[model samples]
Target: MAERRPRREPRGLGWDGREFEVTVGPVAHGGHCVARHEGRVVFVRHSLPGERVVVRVTEDRHPGFCRADAVEVLEASPARVERPCPFSGPGKCGGCDWQHVDVAEQHRLKADVVREQLVRLGRLDAADPVVAGLVVEELPGGALRWRSRARFAVDRDGAPGLRRHRSHDVVVLPDCPITVEPAARAVLGRDWSGAGAVDVAVDSAGVVTTTRLDRRGRPTATRVLRPGADVPEEPAGRAERRAGGRDWEVEGTGFWQVHPAAADALVAAVGEFAQVRPGETVLDLYAGAGLFGGALAPAVGAEGRVVCVEADPGACAAADANLADLPQAEVWQGEVDAEGLGELLAELGSGPDVVVLDPPRAGAGRDVSRLLAGTGARAVVYVACDPASLGRDVAAFAEGGYRLAGVRGFDAFPMTQHVECVALLVSTAR
Candidate 1:
């Protein structure tokens, strides 16, 4: 029998503009391709695998893979499209990368990314089942209300905008399409004579809230929670309830997904997947401002318990006050890890039956997943911003006993590659 031959490596090239036939590597969340040049791994933008291309290295790294910006397209994939958004030009003022690709094809790329990450990094056990995004658009009801919270940097010329896709330079977007005109109006319309940062959020009800130092020089809590919506009885509750909006006040600009409806769908899906009973104890990992725990409290009825673990100080404070009315919920202020979870579980005196993990785009740490796997929890609902990381955590949970029970997609951001996903994993033994 002939011995197995070593796999040929990808052709690696330096900043040379030379052309090469390169297989399009897996598409990453941000629209970069993980390609092999010779043998080393390099991240290239605007370059798809299978179609050979000559690319220019915008960022050069020695001893480490460099980042390249595709300068020439020798071959193009059928999935590629002429990007419609003018903001996505080569200057890179826009944030989205898959705009040049068809919407359905974009989803296929995302699904592929999720699968590859789960297999290679997360150790996922996915096969024929396909994971795709929800049909829901970013702006449902014909209202662009998804961008609930945004921080527009105040430019030197008084223009409010986002930084260029890859550069620190700001783009003067007098009006942003992702946000409603009114919500964006306040940002673009506001006079930034003396302000350094302008924070804005818009509710689904078309109500806009602006938080920042007023021209009067005082910190303000502006809320557009709507006229009929019930305000939380407590002031702290007000922060949590209104925080999930276009202008949802972030705790000092920490990490958060921008889509309100998408987040709601994610949380609602998580609640359903976990199958929270009337008295089951649930652990909310990376619980920012008690959004999931607080929302789950009512869904689980009076007998349930939701222990929220959050590392952000500001978010935890809001979470504590938000769940103040719900005696069944508690916000544990700490990092998410095995030790922290163990101590929290010990305090409960009983293990949780439902687990909801909503980590950052980076996903959850393996230790916490391992610990949760060993517990009495029979099901886990993992919510993720980066499917790459989500797949990784899914693999970890699979190792612990949880099986990929169900998967759903949500279009939190339309006209962009970014989307949200929730995975339901149930214990195999149970």
Candidate 2:
């Protein structure tokens, strides 16, 4: 006999199917703004602050609040705009949240959310000028077609699409304008039935490679697809990128900035903030493909030492090849937590003059920040993708006697709620 499947019990706050009009309040952290209906807190999406809208509750599983999407705007905000993507809506593609808002207003909303998260969760001062004057700057193309990389889910029917909000159901995406031309051509209108998912990336040379992952989540094959060509079945291997005035070769599936201008922008920002000089010892933690490490090598000069630590073996190998020109640069493979970082520092026998860490979305945790604080580095440049995680780690850094010196936000993922941040911290004892 087949094993019995466990039944799912109904869970809700008694407001699941409710519909009501709400006056949207300030923007919250996760692509939504807070509002109240009949004294019950509501988190509404697809709406802007100061707008009066009628919403349909999408989720009410949690106590005290229900999640909703604005169905009809009785009084629309000035920033409201016609959503460009047909897939974006109340129950459609969940990829782009702020597509309904004007591009400029989306920046403002993201900036507001970043500031609020830092101040509220990180306990950063609201009166701080840098925190208060935070703004999300756009890239070269403004907001359209900036993504050089995109991943799509494969539905049971073998169609490549994006998942719906809070769901595993794939929303068919025949076209996505936000992706770079190469990536857009690779997956859109393609049938990926043989794979569980597909990742498409466009290198600086404009070559688009698509990697199809099997149902077991292993890469079945990867191939370079010509514009409007069908997906190929052979591995194309590595791709080259030019950034920080140097050449970098990474695996077709490696972690590189998805935005066209992100690598240069971040390298410049970190250099300006950290100000690494000749003879300085620099540490690049979580250094993928040596983007930051390569940039710092020239600044630190022949007399200086630049060490790049990466947990991924493939990324470390890529970093090694990318920074081969710099005699002073070295790559160490390991995690970036207290134990891993501590052992590496001991091996170096001296502390770094400047440290740059670009950890994953779950920003370098408390233990990592605490370890970094004791390293005696004069400056630490942190590149964060999630504000909440950054805020939490910033608080942890404070406990290690480091202070938040400066932070800059970027609207890298336009139309989406994600924002990139580069933070500079200084040791109080330095």
Question: What are the Cα lDDT values of the candidates?
Answer: 0.66, 0.88
Candidate RMSDs in Å, in order, are: 8.2, 3.1
28-144, model 2: which lDDT tens digit per residue? 988899999877889998999999999999999867788999999999998999888888989999898999999999889988988888898778898888789888888777677
Q: Which candidate has the highest TM-score of all?
A: 2
* Model 1 per-residue lDDT tens digits across residues 75-113: 788877786656664456555666667666666666666
Best by lDDT: 2
Superposition error at 170 for model 2 (Å): 0.2
Reference-based TM-score of each model: 0.76, 0.95
Q: How close is candidate 1 to the true structure, as a TM-score?
A: 0.76
Model 2: number of clashes?
0
